[model samples]
Target: MPTHSVLIRDQALVTRLLQQYLHLLKTYPIITKSVTSAVLSALGNLLSQVLESKKKRKDGQSGKEVDVYGPLRFAVYGLVITGPLSHHFYHLLELLFPASAPFSLLKRLLLERLIFAPAFLLLFFAVMNTLEGKTHSDLQDKLKARYWPALKMNWKVWTPFQFININYVPVQYRVLFANLIALFWNAYLTSVRK
Candidate 1:
Protein backbone atom coordinates (compact mmCIF):
# COMPACT_ATOMS: atom_id res chain seq x y z
CA MET A 1 0.00 0.00 0.00
CA PRO A 2 1.64 3.22 -1.16
CA THR A 3 0.48 6.70 -0.31
CA HIS A 4 -0.30 9.39 -2.89
CA SER A 5 2.83 11.33 -1.94
CA VAL A 6 4.94 8.22 -2.51
CA LEU A 7 3.39 7.74 -5.93
CA ILE A 8 4.07 11.38 -6.76
CA ARG A 9 7.67 10.98 -5.70
CA ASP A 10 7.99 7.83 -7.80
CA GLN A 11 6.58 9.60 -10.80
CA ALA A 12 8.92 12.51 -10.32
CA LEU A 13 11.88 10.15 -10.10
CA VAL A 14 10.82 8.43 -13.26
CA THR A 15 10.49 11.75 -15.04
CA ARG A 16 13.95 12.77 -13.96
CA LEU A 17 15.40 9.47 -15.10
CA LEU A 18 13.72 9.78 -18.45
CA GLN A 19 15.05 13.27 -18.89
CA GLN A 20 18.57 12.11 -18.11
CA TYR A 21 18.20 9.25 -20.56
CA LEU A 22 17.09 11.67 -23.27
CA HIS A 23 20.06 13.85 -22.54
CA LEU A 24 22.30 10.85 -22.89
CA LEU A 25 20.62 9.94 -26.15
CA LYS A 26 21.21 13.41 -27.50
CA THR A 27 24.81 13.47 -26.41
CA TYR A 28 25.79 9.86 -27.16
CA PRO A 29 23.12 8.32 -29.29
CA ILE A 30 24.89 5.21 -30.58
CA ILE A 31 26.53 4.18 -27.33
CA THR A 32 23.42 4.80 -25.27
CA LYS A 33 21.23 2.83 -27.64
CA SER A 34 23.76 0.03 -27.88
CA VAL A 35 24.08 -0.37 -24.13
CA THR A 36 20.32 -0.17 -23.74
CA SER A 37 19.83 -2.83 -26.39
CA ALA A 38 22.45 -5.06 -24.86
CA VAL A 39 20.83 -4.89 -21.44
CA LEU A 40 17.36 -5.55 -22.79
CA SER A 41 18.53 -8.39 -25.01
CA ALA A 42 20.23 -10.09 -22.07
CA LEU A 43 17.09 -9.66 -20.00
CA GLY A 44 15.02 -11.16 -22.80
CA ASN A 45 17.19 -14.24 -22.95
CA LEU A 46 16.99 -14.59 -19.19
CA LEU A 47 13.23 -14.25 -19.39
CA SER A 48 13.07 -17.02 -21.96
CA GLN A 49 15.19 -19.29 -19.82
CA VAL A 50 13.07 -18.59 -16.77
CA LEU A 51 9.86 -19.34 -18.65
CA GLU A 52 11.32 -22.55 -20.03
CA SER A 53 12.42 -23.61 -16.58
CA LYS A 54 8.96 -22.91 -15.17
CA LYS A 55 7.37 -24.89 -17.97
CA LYS A 56 9.66 -27.82 -17.29
CA ARG A 57 8.92 -27.69 -13.60
CA LYS A 58 5.18 -27.55 -14.26
CA ASP A 59 5.53 -30.62 -16.39
CA GLY A 60 7.24 -32.41 -13.46
CA GLN A 61 10.53 -32.56 -15.33
CA SER A 62 13.80 -31.44 -13.85
CA GLY A 63 14.81 -28.09 -15.22
CA LYS A 64 18.00 -28.00 -17.21
CA GLU A 65 20.83 -25.81 -16.01
CA VAL A 66 20.66 -22.24 -17.18
CA ASP A 67 22.88 -21.51 -20.14
CA VAL A 68 24.93 -18.55 -18.95
CA TYR A 69 26.37 -18.08 -22.43
CA GLY A 70 23.00 -17.56 -24.05
CA PRO A 71 22.36 -14.19 -22.47
CA LEU A 72 25.97 -13.18 -23.02
CA ARG A 73 25.67 -13.98 -26.70
CA PHE A 74 22.44 -12.02 -27.01
CA ALA A 75 23.99 -9.06 -25.25
CA VAL A 76 26.96 -9.07 -27.60
CA TYR A 77 24.76 -9.32 -30.65
CA GLY A 78 22.54 -6.47 -29.48
CA LEU A 79 25.48 -4.25 -28.65
CA VAL A 80 27.51 -4.94 -31.75
CA ILE A 81 24.86 -5.61 -34.37
CA THR A 82 21.28 -4.64 -33.60
CA GLY A 83 21.86 -1.22 -32.08
CA PRO A 84 24.15 0.11 -34.77
CA LEU A 85 22.27 -1.54 -37.60
CA SER A 86 18.90 -0.16 -36.47
CA HIS A 87 20.37 3.27 -35.83
CA HIS A 88 21.71 3.45 -39.36
CA PHE A 89 18.71 1.75 -40.94
CA TYR A 90 16.21 4.18 -39.46
CA HIS A 91 18.35 7.13 -40.41
CA LEU A 92 18.61 5.79 -43.94
CA LEU A 93 14.88 5.27 -44.08
CA GLU A 94 14.24 8.86 -43.10
CA LEU A 95 16.74 10.05 -45.64
CA LEU A 96 15.23 7.93 -48.37
CA PHE A 97 11.59 8.48 -47.50
CA PRO A 98 11.01 11.91 -46.09
CA ALA A 99 7.52 12.38 -44.71
CA SER A 100 6.54 14.87 -47.44
CA ALA A 101 7.35 12.36 -50.15
CA PRO A 102 4.41 10.73 -51.88
CA PHE A 103 3.30 7.52 -50.20
CA SER A 104 6.27 7.71 -47.86
CA LEU A 105 4.70 5.58 -45.18
CA LEU A 106 3.76 2.82 -47.55
CA LYS A 107 7.15 2.83 -49.22
CA ARG A 108 8.96 2.65 -45.92
CA LEU A 109 6.78 -0.18 -44.71
CA LEU A 110 7.21 -2.18 -47.89
CA LEU A 111 10.96 -1.75 -47.91
CA GLU A 112 11.25 -2.75 -44.31
CA ARG A 113 8.93 -5.74 -44.57
CA LEU A 114 10.27 -6.98 -47.86
CA ILE A 115 13.97 -6.21 -47.69
CA PHE A 116 15.18 -5.36 -44.22
CA ALA A 117 13.18 -7.94 -42.32
CA PRO A 118 14.28 -10.95 -44.32
CA ALA A 119 17.90 -9.87 -44.54
CA PHE A 120 18.01 -9.04 -40.86
CA LEU A 121 16.53 -12.39 -39.93
CA LEU A 122 19.04 -14.16 -42.11
CA LEU A 123 21.83 -12.21 -40.49
CA PHE A 124 20.46 -13.08 -37.06
CA PHE A 125 20.44 -16.78 -37.84
CA ALA A 126 23.94 -16.70 -39.28
CA VAL A 127 25.33 -14.71 -36.39
CA MET A 128 23.68 -16.84 -33.75
CA ASN A 129 24.84 -20.00 -35.47
CA THR A 130 28.39 -18.68 -35.53
CA LEU A 131 28.15 -17.59 -31.92
CA GLU A 132 26.94 -21.04 -30.98
CA GLY A 133 30.10 -22.44 -32.62
CA LYS A 134 28.21 -24.44 -35.19
CA THR A 135 29.95 -25.42 -38.40
CA HIS A 136 28.97 -24.08 -41.82
CA SER A 137 26.94 -27.18 -42.65
CA ASP A 138 25.02 -26.83 -39.42
CA LEU A 139 24.36 -23.18 -40.25
CA GLN A 140 23.04 -24.14 -43.64
CA ASP A 141 20.73 -26.73 -42.10
CA LYS A 142 19.46 -24.18 -39.58
CA LEU A 143 18.77 -21.69 -42.34
CA LYS A 144 16.81 -24.28 -44.28
CA ALA A 145 14.71 -25.34 -41.31
CA ARG A 146 14.18 -22.17 -39.28
CA TYR A 147 14.69 -19.20 -41.57
CA TRP A 148 11.44 -19.33 -43.51
CA PRO A 149 9.32 -20.00 -40.45
CA ALA A 150 10.92 -17.17 -38.53
CA LEU A 151 10.57 -14.78 -41.43
CA LYS A 152 6.89 -15.62 -41.73
CA MET A 153 6.44 -15.02 -38.02
CA ASN A 154 8.42 -11.82 -38.24
CA TRP A 155 6.20 -10.55 -41.03
CA LYS A 156 3.12 -11.38 -39.00
CA VAL A 157 4.33 -9.77 -35.78
CA TRP A 158 6.49 -6.85 -36.87
CA THR A 159 4.69 -5.39 -39.88
CA PRO A 160 2.21 -3.43 -37.80
CA PHE A 161 4.84 -2.33 -35.33
CA GLN A 162 7.17 -1.18 -38.10
CA PHE A 163 4.37 0.76 -39.71
CA ILE A 164 3.73 2.63 -36.50
CA ASN A 165 7.39 3.07 -35.74
CA ILE A 166 8.26 4.45 -39.13
CA ASN A 167 5.23 6.66 -39.49
CA TYR A 168 4.78 7.96 -35.96
CA VAL A 169 7.86 7.70 -33.76
CA PRO A 170 10.44 10.45 -33.80
CA VAL A 171 13.72 9.70 -35.54
CA GLN A 172 16.01 10.04 -32.54
CA TYR A 173 14.00 7.57 -30.51
CA ARG A 174 13.52 4.89 -33.16
CA VAL A 175 16.23 2.54 -31.95
CA LEU A 176 15.05 2.82 -28.38
CA PHE A 177 11.51 2.16 -29.52
CA ALA A 178 12.66 -0.84 -31.52
CA ASN A 179 14.77 -2.05 -28.63
CA LEU A 180 11.79 -2.01 -26.31
CA ILE A 181 9.83 -4.07 -28.80
CA ALA A 182 12.84 -6.32 -29.28
CA LEU A 183 12.80 -7.18 -25.61
CA PHE A 184 9.89 -9.51 -26.27
CA TRP A 185 11.12 -10.19 -29.76
CA ASN A 186 14.45 -11.33 -28.42
CA ALA A 187 12.73 -13.71 -26.00
CA TYR A 188 10.87 -15.27 -28.88
CA LEU A 189 14.08 -15.41 -30.91
CA THR A 190 15.92 -17.13 -28.09
CA SER A 191 13.16 -19.72 -27.78
CA VAL A 192 13.23 -20.29 -31.50
CA ARG A 193 16.98 -20.77 -31.44
CA LYS A 194 16.63 -23.30 -28.68
Candidate 2:
Protein backbone atom coordinates (compact mmCIF):
# COMPACT_ATOMS: atom_id res chain seq x y z
CA MET A 1 0.00 0.00 0.00
CA PRO A 2 1.39 3.30 1.15
CA THR A 3 4.51 1.52 2.30
CA HIS A 4 5.51 0.55 -1.20
CA SER A 5 4.83 4.08 -2.46
CA VAL A 6 6.79 5.42 0.47
CA LEU A 7 9.60 3.03 -0.29
CA ILE A 8 9.48 3.96 -3.93
CA ARG A 9 9.78 7.63 -3.00
CA ASP A 10 12.52 6.98 -0.45
CA GLN A 11 14.39 4.34 -2.35
CA ALA A 12 17.56 4.47 -0.30
CA LEU A 13 16.08 3.35 3.04
CA VAL A 14 13.78 0.70 1.62
CA THR A 15 16.48 -0.63 -0.69
CA ARG A 16 18.86 -1.00 2.25
CA LEU A 17 16.27 -2.76 4.39
CA LEU A 18 15.25 -5.04 1.51
CA GLN A 19 18.88 -6.00 0.81
CA GLN A 20 19.46 -6.76 4.49
CA TYR A 21 16.30 -8.86 4.64
CA LEU A 22 17.31 -10.75 1.51
CA HIS A 23 20.78 -11.40 2.94
CA LEU A 24 19.26 -12.71 6.16
CA LEU A 25 17.05 -15.09 4.21
CA LYS A 26 19.88 -16.22 1.92
CA THR A 27 22.24 -16.81 4.81
CA TYR A 28 19.81 -18.54 7.18
CA PRO A 29 16.95 -19.88 5.14
CA ILE A 30 16.18 -22.54 7.76
CA ILE A 31 15.62 -19.87 10.38
CA THR A 32 15.14 -16.62 8.49
CA LYS A 33 12.74 -17.76 5.79
CA SER A 34 10.61 -19.33 8.47
CA VAL A 35 10.74 -16.73 11.21
CA THR A 36 11.89 -13.61 9.43
CA SER A 37 9.18 -13.75 6.81
CA ALA A 38 6.51 -14.05 9.49
CA VAL A 39 8.18 -11.55 11.78
CA LEU A 40 8.76 -9.01 9.05
CA SER A 41 5.17 -9.40 7.90
CA ALA A 42 3.87 -8.86 11.41
CA LEU A 43 6.15 -5.91 12.04
CA GLY A 44 5.26 -4.37 8.73
CA ASN A 45 1.64 -4.66 9.82
CA LEU A 46 2.37 -3.12 13.23
CA LEU A 47 4.26 -0.23 11.66
CA SER A 48 1.34 0.46 9.36
CA GLN A 49 -0.96 0.57 12.35
CA VAL A 50 1.36 2.95 14.17
CA LEU A 51 1.49 5.25 11.19
CA GLU A 52 -2.27 5.16 10.81
CA SER A 53 -2.71 6.10 14.48
CA LYS A 54 -0.33 9.02 14.09
CA LYS A 55 -2.20 10.25 11.06
CA LYS A 56 -5.67 9.93 12.57
CA ARG A 57 -5.40 9.75 16.33
CA LYS A 58 -9.07 10.49 16.87
CA ASP A 59 -10.07 7.68 14.50
CA GLY A 60 -9.16 5.27 17.33
CA GLN A 61 -6.20 3.06 16.51
CA SER A 62 -4.83 0.17 18.53
CA GLY A 63 -1.43 -1.23 19.39
CA LYS A 64 -2.56 -4.54 20.78
CA GLU A 65 -0.10 -7.36 21.26
CA VAL A 66 -0.40 -9.95 18.52
CA ASP A 67 -0.42 -13.63 19.45
CA VAL A 68 2.75 -14.82 17.75
CA TYR A 69 1.90 -18.52 18.16
CA GLY A 70 -0.01 -18.46 14.86
CA PRO A 71 2.98 -17.02 13.02
CA LEU A 72 5.25 -19.58 14.72
CA ARG A 73 3.06 -22.43 13.54
CA PHE A 74 3.18 -20.94 10.04
CA ALA A 75 6.95 -20.65 10.40
CA VAL A 76 7.19 -24.38 11.19
CA TYR A 77 5.24 -25.16 8.03
CA GLY A 78 7.49 -22.87 5.98
CA LEU A 79 10.65 -24.35 7.49
CA VAL A 80 9.75 -28.05 7.32
CA ILE A 81 7.95 -27.99 3.98
CA THR A 82 8.82 -24.99 1.85
CA GLY A 83 12.38 -24.09 2.88
CA PRO A 84 14.04 -27.51 2.80
CA LEU A 85 12.16 -28.59 -0.31
CA SER A 86 13.36 -25.48 -2.15
CA HIS A 87 16.96 -25.94 -0.96
CA HIS A 88 17.05 -29.63 -1.92
CA PHE A 89 15.47 -28.92 -5.28
CA TYR A 90 18.02 -26.18 -5.95
CA HIS A 91 20.95 -28.48 -5.19
CA LEU A 92 19.53 -31.43 -7.11
CA LEU A 93 18.81 -29.26 -10.16
CA GLU A 94 22.27 -27.68 -10.00
CA LEU A 95 23.86 -31.11 -10.24
CA LEU A 96 21.58 -32.11 -13.12
CA PHE A 97 22.13 -28.93 -15.13
CA PRO A 98 24.99 -26.85 -13.84
CA ALA A 99 24.61 -24.19 -16.53
CA SER A 100 20.88 -23.58 -16.51
CA ALA A 101 19.12 -21.28 -14.06
CA PRO A 102 15.41 -20.86 -13.52
CA PHE A 103 14.38 -17.21 -14.03
CA SER A 104 10.62 -17.30 -13.96
CA LEU A 105 7.73 -19.23 -12.42
CA LEU A 106 6.99 -20.77 -15.79
CA LYS A 107 10.59 -21.87 -16.19
CA ARG A 108 10.79 -23.19 -12.65
CA LEU A 109 7.46 -25.00 -12.85
CA LEU A 110 8.38 -26.47 -16.23
CA LEU A 111 11.71 -27.65 -14.87
CA GLU A 112 10.05 -29.20 -11.85
CA ARG A 113 7.42 -30.92 -13.97
CA LEU A 114 10.01 -32.25 -16.41
CA ILE A 115 12.52 -33.42 -13.82
CA PHE A 116 10.95 -33.86 -10.40
CA ALA A 117 7.17 -34.15 -10.50
CA PRO A 118 6.92 -37.56 -12.15
CA ALA A 119 9.48 -39.19 -9.90
CA PHE A 120 8.17 -37.54 -6.78
CA LEU A 121 4.57 -38.37 -7.64
CA LEU A 122 5.37 -42.04 -8.14
CA LEU A 123 7.25 -42.27 -4.84
CA PHE A 124 4.63 -40.23 -3.03
CA PHE A 125 1.70 -42.29 -4.25
CA ALA A 126 3.51 -45.54 -3.57
CA VAL A 127 4.19 -44.52 0.01
CA MET A 128 0.65 -43.27 0.50
CA ASN A 129 -1.01 -46.26 -1.04
CA THR A 130 1.21 -48.66 0.92
CA LEU A 131 0.54 -46.87 4.21
CA GLU A 132 -3.19 -46.76 3.52
CA GLY A 133 -3.34 -50.41 2.39
CA LYS A 134 -4.99 -49.37 -0.85
CA THR A 135 -5.91 -52.27 -3.10
CA HIS A 136 -6.14 -51.87 -6.86
CA SER A 137 -9.88 -51.43 -6.58
CA ASP A 138 -9.44 -48.95 -3.73
CA LEU A 139 -6.92 -46.95 -5.73
CA GLN A 140 -9.19 -46.95 -8.74
CA ASP A 141 -12.12 -45.96 -6.57
CA LYS A 142 -10.04 -43.11 -5.10
CA LEU A 143 -9.05 -41.87 -8.53
CA LYS A 144 -12.62 -42.06 -9.72
CA ALA A 145 -14.14 -40.48 -6.62
CA ARG A 146 -11.49 -38.02 -5.43
CA TYR A 147 -9.52 -36.84 -8.42
CA TRP A 148 -12.33 -34.99 -10.19
CA PRO A 149 -13.53 -33.49 -6.93
CA ALA A 150 -10.04 -32.20 -6.17
CA LEU A 151 -9.58 -30.86 -9.67
CA LYS A 152 -12.96 -29.15 -9.56
CA MET A 153 -12.24 -27.67 -6.15
CA ASN A 154 -8.88 -26.38 -7.32
CA TRP A 155 -10.39 -24.81 -10.42
CA LYS A 156 -13.63 -23.52 -8.93
CA VAL A 157 -12.45 -22.36 -5.53
CA TRP A 158 -8.69 -21.97 -5.17
CA THR A 159 -8.11 -20.54 -8.63
CA PRO A 160 -10.64 -17.75 -8.12
CA PHE A 161 -9.11 -16.89 -4.77
CA GLN A 162 -5.62 -16.96 -6.30
CA PHE A 163 -6.70 -14.73 -9.16
CA ILE A 164 -7.95 -12.12 -6.70
CA ASN A 165 -4.55 -12.05 -5.04
CA ILE A 166 -2.79 -12.02 -8.37
CA ASN A 167 -4.54 -8.75 -9.21
CA TYR A 168 -2.37 -6.99 -6.65
CA VAL A 169 1.02 -8.67 -6.78
CA PRO A 170 2.77 -6.22 -4.48
CA VAL A 171 5.40 -7.28 -1.94
CA GLN A 172 3.13 -6.69 1.08
CA TYR A 173 0.36 -8.46 -0.78
CA ARG A 174 2.61 -11.51 -1.14
CA VAL A 175 2.87 -11.85 2.66
CA LEU A 176 -0.88 -11.53 3.00
CA PHE A 177 -1.25 -14.03 0.19
CA ALA A 178 0.94 -16.49 2.07
CA ASN A 179 -1.20 -15.96 5.17
CA LEU A 180 -4.33 -16.55 3.11
CA ILE A 181 -2.83 -19.74 1.67
CA ALA A 182 -2.16 -20.99 5.17
CA LEU A 183 -5.75 -20.16 6.03
CA PHE A 184 -7.00 -22.05 2.99
CA TRP A 185 -4.88 -25.09 3.86
CA ASN A 186 -6.25 -25.10 7.40
CA ALA A 187 -9.80 -24.81 6.12
CA TYR A 188 -9.25 -27.59 3.58
CA LEU A 189 -7.77 -29.94 6.18
CA THR A 190 -10.64 -29.27 8.54
CA SER A 191 -13.13 -29.92 5.75
CA VAL A 192 -11.43 -33.24 4.99
CA ARG A 193 -11.56 -34.31 8.62
CA LYS A 194 -13.98 -37.07 9.48
Candidate 3:
Protein backbone atom coordinates (compact mmCIF):
# COMPACT_ATOMS: atom_id res chain seq x y z
CA MET A 1 0.00 0.00 0.00
CA PRO A 2 1.24 3.48 -0.81
CA THR A 3 2.10 5.75 2.17
CA HIS A 4 -0.24 8.50 0.91
CA SER A 5 -3.08 6.02 0.57
CA VAL A 6 -2.56 4.84 4.17
CA LEU A 7 -2.57 8.42 5.40
CA ILE A 8 -5.81 9.12 3.61
CA ARG A 9 -7.40 6.00 5.07
CA ASP A 10 -6.37 7.06 8.60
CA GLN A 11 -7.82 10.55 8.07
CA ALA A 12 -11.06 9.04 6.78
CA LEU A 13 -11.30 6.79 9.81
CA VAL A 14 -10.82 9.75 12.14
CA THR A 15 -13.43 11.77 10.25
CA ARG A 16 -15.94 8.96 10.52
CA LEU A 17 -15.34 8.59 14.24
CA LEU A 18 -15.80 12.30 14.80
CA GLN A 19 -18.99 12.28 12.80
CA GLN A 20 -20.32 9.43 14.89
CA TYR A 21 -19.51 11.30 18.08
CA LEU A 22 -21.24 14.41 16.81
CA HIS A 23 -24.30 12.38 15.97
CA LEU A 24 -24.32 10.94 19.47
CA LEU A 25 -24.01 14.45 20.90
CA LYS A 26 -26.95 15.60 18.88
CA THR A 27 -29.06 12.64 19.97
CA TYR A 28 -28.05 12.59 23.63
CA PRO A 29 -26.28 15.76 24.52
CA ILE A 30 -26.35 15.47 28.30
CA ILE A 31 -25.50 11.79 28.40
CA THR A 32 -22.67 12.14 25.91
CA LYS A 33 -21.18 15.06 27.79
CA SER A 34 -21.63 13.31 31.12
CA VAL A 35 -19.80 10.19 29.99
CA THR A 36 -17.04 12.23 28.39
CA SER A 37 -16.65 14.28 31.59
CA ALA A 38 -16.56 11.16 33.74
CA VAL A 39 -13.80 9.56 31.71
CA LEU A 40 -11.68 12.71 31.53
CA SER A 41 -12.13 13.55 35.19
CA ALA A 42 -11.11 10.07 36.23
CA LEU A 43 -8.05 10.27 34.03
CA GLY A 44 -7.17 13.61 35.58
CA ASN A 45 -7.26 12.18 39.08
CA LEU A 46 -5.16 9.24 37.95
CA LEU A 47 -2.64 11.60 36.40
CA SER A 48 -2.41 13.56 39.63
CA GLN A 49 -1.84 10.38 41.64
CA VAL A 50 0.83 9.21 39.22
CA LEU A 51 2.68 12.53 39.45
CA GLU A 52 2.48 12.47 43.24
CA SER A 53 3.87 8.95 43.29
CA LYS A 54 6.77 9.99 41.08
CA LYS A 55 7.46 12.98 43.29
CA LYS A 56 7.52 10.77 46.34
CA ARG A 57 9.98 8.38 44.71
CA LYS A 58 12.21 11.29 43.74
CA ASP A 59 12.16 12.66 47.29
CA GLY A 60 13.26 9.31 48.78
CA GLN A 61 9.93 8.83 50.49
CA SER A 62 7.92 5.64 50.47
CA GLY A 63 5.20 5.81 47.85
CA LYS A 64 1.70 5.80 49.20
CA GLU A 65 -0.74 3.33 47.75
CA VAL A 66 -2.98 4.88 45.11
CA ASP A 67 -6.38 5.61 46.52
CA VAL A 68 -8.56 3.57 44.21
CA TYR A 69 -11.61 5.62 45.17
CA GLY A 70 -10.11 8.94 44.15
CA PRO A 71 -10.78 8.54 40.46
CA LEU A 72 -14.17 7.05 41.16
CA ARG A 73 -15.14 10.11 43.15
CA PHE A 74 -14.03 12.39 40.37
CA ALA A 75 -15.97 10.32 37.84
CA VAL A 76 -19.13 10.62 39.87
CA TYR A 77 -18.66 14.33 40.34
CA GLY A 78 -18.07 14.87 36.66
CA LEU A 79 -21.10 12.89 35.63
CA VAL A 80 -23.50 14.22 38.21
CA ILE A 81 -22.35 17.81 38.46
CA THR A 82 -19.85 19.09 35.94
CA GLY A 83 -21.47 17.75 32.77
CA PRO A 84 -25.05 18.79 33.39
CA LEU A 85 -24.07 22.09 34.90
CA SER A 86 -21.68 23.07 32.12
CA HIS A 87 -24.08 22.04 29.38
CA HIS A 88 -26.83 24.23 30.79
CA PHE A 89 -24.53 27.03 31.80
CA TYR A 90 -23.22 27.44 28.28
CA HIS A 91 -26.74 27.43 26.94
CA LEU A 92 -27.78 30.08 29.41
CA LEU A 93 -24.88 32.22 28.38
CA GLU A 94 -25.95 32.05 24.75
CA LEU A 95 -29.51 32.98 25.66
CA LEU A 96 -28.42 35.83 27.84
CA PHE A 97 -25.92 37.29 25.43
CA PRO A 98 -26.51 36.48 21.82
CA ALA A 99 -23.57 36.86 19.46
CA SER A 100 -25.03 39.93 17.79
CA ALA A 101 -25.45 41.83 21.04
CA PRO A 102 -23.02 44.63 21.76
CA PHE A 103 -20.24 43.60 24.17
CA SER A 104 -21.64 40.04 24.21
CA LEU A 105 -18.17 38.64 24.46
CA LEU A 106 -17.27 40.81 27.44
CA LYS A 107 -20.61 40.14 29.10
CA ARG A 108 -20.20 36.40 28.83
CA LEU A 109 -16.64 36.53 30.09
CA LEU A 110 -17.51 38.66 33.09
CA LEU A 111 -20.55 36.58 34.02
CA GLU A 112 -18.62 33.36 33.75
CA ARG A 113 -15.45 34.48 35.47
CA LEU A 114 -16.95 36.70 38.11
CA ILE A 115 -20.06 34.78 39.05
CA PHE A 116 -19.94 31.25 37.72
CA ALA A 117 -16.33 30.51 38.49
CA PRO A 118 -16.50 31.28 42.20
CA ALA A 119 -19.80 29.52 42.67
CA PHE A 120 -18.60 26.46 40.81
CA LEU A 121 -15.48 26.22 42.93
CA LEU A 122 -17.52 26.32 46.09
CA LEU A 123 -19.82 23.65 44.76
CA PHE A 124 -16.85 21.48 43.87
CA PHE A 125 -15.37 21.75 47.35
CA ALA A 126 -18.66 21.11 49.06
CA VAL A 127 -19.54 18.12 46.91
CA MET A 128 -16.10 16.58 47.18
CA ASN A 129 -16.20 17.11 50.92
CA THR A 130 -19.52 15.33 51.20
CA LEU A 131 -18.33 12.53 48.93
CA GLU A 132 -15.30 12.09 51.17
CA GLY A 133 -17.66 11.80 54.17
CA LYS A 134 -16.30 14.84 55.84
CA THR A 135 -18.25 16.87 58.39
CA HIS A 136 -19.88 20.27 57.85
CA SER A 137 -17.24 21.76 60.10
CA ASP A 138 -14.62 20.24 57.87
CA LEU A 139 -16.27 21.80 54.86
CA GLN A 140 -16.27 25.19 56.52
CA ASP A 141 -12.64 24.81 57.49
CA LYS A 142 -11.76 23.83 53.96
CA LEU A 143 -13.52 26.88 52.57
CA LYS A 144 -11.76 29.15 54.95
CA ALA A 145 -8.41 27.67 54.15
CA ARG A 146 -8.64 27.00 50.45
CA TYR A 147 -11.48 28.88 48.80
CA TRP A 148 -9.81 32.22 48.24
CA PRO A 149 -6.56 30.71 47.02
CA ALA A 150 -8.36 28.38 44.67
CA LEU A 151 -10.59 31.14 43.38
CA LYS A 152 -7.56 33.30 42.78
CA MET A 153 -5.85 30.52 40.93
CA ASN A 154 -8.98 29.87 38.93
CA TRP A 155 -9.22 33.51 37.90
CA LYS A 156 -5.59 33.51 36.84
CA VAL A 157 -5.74 30.28 34.85
CA TRP A 158 -9.27 30.09 33.51
CA THR A 159 -9.96 33.73 32.65
CA PRO A 160 -8.28 33.73 29.26
CA PHE A 161 -9.40 30.22 28.40
CA GLN A 162 -13.00 30.98 29.31
CA PHE A 163 -12.85 34.09 27.13
CA ILE A 164 -11.80 32.01 24.16
CA ASN A 165 -14.20 29.22 24.89
CA ILE A 166 -17.23 31.46 25.27
CA ASN A 167 -16.51 33.66 22.30
CA TYR A 168 -15.00 31.32 19.72
CA VAL A 169 -16.10 27.73 20.36
CA PRO A 170 -19.43 26.65 18.95
CA VAL A 171 -22.17 26.10 21.52
CA GLN A 172 -22.45 22.39 20.80
CA TYR A 173 -18.73 21.79 21.33
CA ARG A 174 -18.30 24.12 24.32
CA VAL A 175 -18.61 21.44 26.94
CA LEU A 176 -16.10 19.24 25.18
CA PHE A 177 -13.61 22.10 24.91
CA ALA A 178 -14.06 22.87 28.59
CA ASN A 179 -13.66 19.22 29.49
CA LEU A 180 -10.41 18.98 27.57
CA ILE A 181 -9.07 22.00 29.42
CA ALA A 182 -10.42 20.60 32.66
CA LEU A 183 -8.19 17.58 32.22
CA PHE A 184 -5.32 19.71 33.49
CA TRP A 185 -7.59 21.87 35.62
CA ASN A 186 -8.87 18.76 37.35
CA ALA A 187 -5.34 17.69 38.14
CA TYR A 188 -4.68 21.09 39.65
CA LEU A 189 -7.94 20.83 41.58
CA THR A 190 -7.01 17.41 42.98
CA SER A 191 -3.69 18.77 44.14
CA VAL A 192 -5.34 21.78 45.75
CA ARG A 193 -7.95 19.66 47.52
CA LYS A 194 -5.25 17.52 49.09
Best by TM-score: 1
- Name every residue pair that clashes in candidate 1: none
Compose the digit string of candidate 1's lDDT tens values, residues 17-96.
Answer: 99999999999999998989899999889888999999999999998888999999999999999888998999999999
lDDT of each prediction vs. the true structure? Answer: 0.91, 0.46, 0.94
TM-score of 1: 0.96
Instruction: Give one digit per residue, the lDDT tens place, for model 2 in 1-194.
Output: 56887877789887898888678756765565445444433344344444444656556655345444433443444445444454456555445544344444344444655444445333423433444556877656655555445444444554444434433343223333544454454334222311
Error of 2 at 10 (Å): 4.3
Clashes of 1: 0
TM-score of candidate 3 against the unseen true structure: 0.94
**Candidate 2 Cα misplacement greater than 4 A, ranges:** 1-10, 36-74, 100-111, 114-194
TM-score per prediction, in order, is: 0.96, 0.37, 0.94
Ranking the candidates on TM-score from highest down gives 1, 3, 2
For each of the candidates, give the backbone clash count: 0, 0, 0
Give the per-residue lDDT of model 3 (tens digit) for 93-187.
99999999999999999999999999999999999999999999999999999999999999999999999999999998999999999999998
Q: Which of candidates 1 and 2 reaches a greater lDDT?
A: 1
State each model's C-alpha RMSD to the native: 1.1, 11.7, 2.0
